[model samples]
Target chain A: MDMRRLVGGNFARLRQAKGLTQEDVEARSGFSQQYISGLERGQRNPTIITLYELAQALGVSHVELITPQNDET
Target chain B: MDMRRLVGGNFARLRQAKGLTQEDVEARSGFSQQYISGLERGQRNPTIITLYELAQALGVSHVELITPQNDET
Candidate 1:
């Protein structure tokens, strides 16, 4: 239920799944690579606007970033 | 690509879809109603942990919250 930790974990997983680097997201989303890194590390608190941009950059819905996968059936 | 605007829009849509009031999410997610309102209004910059918690309370994956629905498609 920790948003930061969950987002960081999910972000890392999704980014890796898509074979994307932080730099790529930064370039696509116009967010700084350092900011993305901070987000992945749970060190940054992003506004909703930032999250939407990140989702767009990732080619996914904004919900995908906040939603938890049903890994446990 | 504005994260806050996207999140706020999506949040409001989802909440309306489920007939959920901000208080309902607040009770379920342990986040304050005011906070949820602010988030929906794109007024709050939540940490990843907070986002994750909100997702749980909403009974969806974290990704769902961050991901944008393909309404056009």
Candidate 2:
């Protein structure tokens, strides 16, 4: 429900779906792998710019990464 | 392209669409009006919980607030 958790969950899901590793995202995003790990665990409170970078690296829009989907709807 | 800017722009847009004010959001989300102002100005880096609360108050998914819209798509 929280943005951090939502972002983390979505990030993991999308990354896995894309068959990407943390290293891959890090390389693409110019962020540290450790940062990616923390982000996935919802341990980091990212800035807007960071979110944009992550979204771009993941090939998803920032909205898709932050919004929670209603599976039923 | 920053998350702060994205969230602020989306928040302002949605709030205006709903005819809600920062005070209304503050009353609904239990946050301060000043904080809302800061948030809407991209001056705040909110926590996940804060984002969730804001989303609920605004009757939107967190994703909608954070993601950038592709006007073409």
Candidate 3:
């Protein structure tokens, strides 16, 4: 699987599901909004630590950030 | 959330559940057995790409490598 795209799709979906903007995720994860935006576009290669931080920001398990949801990426 | 330890525990569990050794994963994932050992011991930090490769070697999704299962870790 394409980890970058998969994580991008899942991150976008999860963040949206939580009614959070990239800026909100940035505030919560200590990651910049630009980084979040890039990740959503599958343009960033995030490590597991980044995934964990983002997942926590979205109020979800880290697993959710990497799982391929139905018809999403 | 210590991502390194979490991935380590999950990876070890998944690998063992598949009845495969570190050497087996090494051969399949092209990651060294020594590296796999360190990772399983929570001593290594793996990128998302590494997680994906290890997951593929274990015949599972990348998410499986990061998921926290019951009574593990």
Candidate 4:
């Protein structure tokens, strides 16, 4: 299981759960919607700080972004 | 609570629990001992891949490094 995909999937799931669009995350985290799209597509190599900011935007722990889900991929 | 310190503490605690030194992590993760030392001091802002690799070296889940422990910091 690739970590990028794992993170991407988690991000998408969390964002959807909160009823947030990419633009919502963009406004909250100051990361562009384009970047958010790239991240959700598993195309970004984010630093820990990026992970931290995203977690902040989503109102969850940073660890949640990187944790593997119950569904095996 | 600083995430860097949290990660550093977790890394240090886990490594010590396993009786492994920075040298041992270097051998397993191909990261320099000096870098490991810096990371242990919370001086390094590691990337996601770095976190993943270090977890591999430590034989723990990557989330463990970033997760806050029971101790108050």
Candidate 5:
């Protein structure tokens, strides 16, 4: 599987689980909406700090953003 | 707290815990020795794919590389 897609899909699922929109994530993460959108679409390869900020914004562990779910495991 | 330092420190610690040197990590992850050294020194902001590969090389979950230890938590 594409690692970027795995990360992007996981990130999107976590954000949606918390009922957050991309705009909300952008606001909380201080990343641009375009950046977050690109991330969710698997068009970006985020740095560790970016992942950290996004996890903080989603109120989840940073691991959650990168780890595949049980189905994928 | 510097997120880069936190990640770098955690990565180094995890690699050490596994008794794997930088060379070992480079060999296992297929990342360059310079890249691994830079990452361990907190001088590199690695992409998610890099982190994923490193975590695999360390035989641990990717989250372990980025998460702060209990002392910092």
Candidate 6:
């Protein structure tokens, strides 16, 4: 299912939906902007704790970061 | 929310609920039994890909590994 791409797309979707930039997530999550950028591009595999922190910073549940939307359906 | 503890507990609970041992998860997940034990014990921070693999090996959604159960309610 290409979970990496799914997660990246979902993360990007959610962040944009919230009107946030990667820098905002970096500031709130204590992760570097490059790291966040990598995650969104599916170029990095983040730890569960990182995902949790990013979710918190994005004002969303961690589950939302991995669940794909209906676009595939 | 002590997210580390929460995720570990959730992972352990879900694995136990499925009646699978750490060894069983290791065999199915291709992750080391020691690593699985550490994760269950809240001593290891697993990557998202690792979480996904664990969930797949456990026959559950990745979200299940991070969601807190109702016992906390």
The Cα local distance difference test for each model comes to: 0.72, 0.78, 0.83, 0.86, 0.80, 0.79
TM-score of chain A of each: 0.83, 0.87, 0.88, 0.92, 0.85, 0.85
Q: Say which prediction, candidate 3 or candidate 4, comes out ahead on TM-score.
A: 4
Q: Which candidate achieves the best TM-score against the true structure?
A: 4
Name the regions of candidate 1 deviating beyond 4 angstroms.
A70-73, B1-73
User: Alpha-carbon error at B68 in model 2, in Å?
Assistant: 3.4
Better of 2 and 3 by TM-score: 3
The per-prediction CA RMSD against the true structure, in angstroms, equals 4.4, 3.0, 1.9, 1.5, 2.3, 2.3
- TM-score of candidate 5 on Cα atoms, chains taken together: 0.81
Judge the docking of candidate 4 as incorrect, acceptable, medium or high.
medium
Angstrom error of the Cα, residue B35, model 1: value is 7.8
Individual DockQ of the candidates?
A: 0.50, 0.54, 0.80, 0.71, 0.70, 0.66
Number of colliding residue pairs in each model? 38, 6, 0, 0, 0, 0
Worst 10 residues of 2 chain B by lDDT: B64-73
lDDT of 3 by residue, A29-70 (tens): 788999888898988778888777777788888877887778
Model 1, range A38-57, lDDT digits (tens) per residue?
Answer: 88897766656566667778
Residue A47 of candidate 4: its Cα lDDT?
78
Better of 1 and 3 by DockQ: 3
Every candidate's chain B TM-score: 0.82, 0.86, 0.87, 0.91, 0.85, 0.82
Model 1, retained fraction of real contacts?
0.81
TM-score of 2: 0.76
Candidate number 5, chain A TM-score: 0.85
Which ranges in model 2 have alpha carbons more than 4 Å from their true place? A69-73, B69-73
**iRMS for all predictions?**
3.4, 2.8, 0.9, 1.2, 1.6, 1.6
How would you encode candidate 5's per-residue C-alpha lDDT over A1-73 as one tens digit per residue? 4667877888889888889888987877788888878888889888888877777888988767777787767
Task: Indicate whether candidate 4 or candidate 6 has the larger lDDT.
Answer: 4
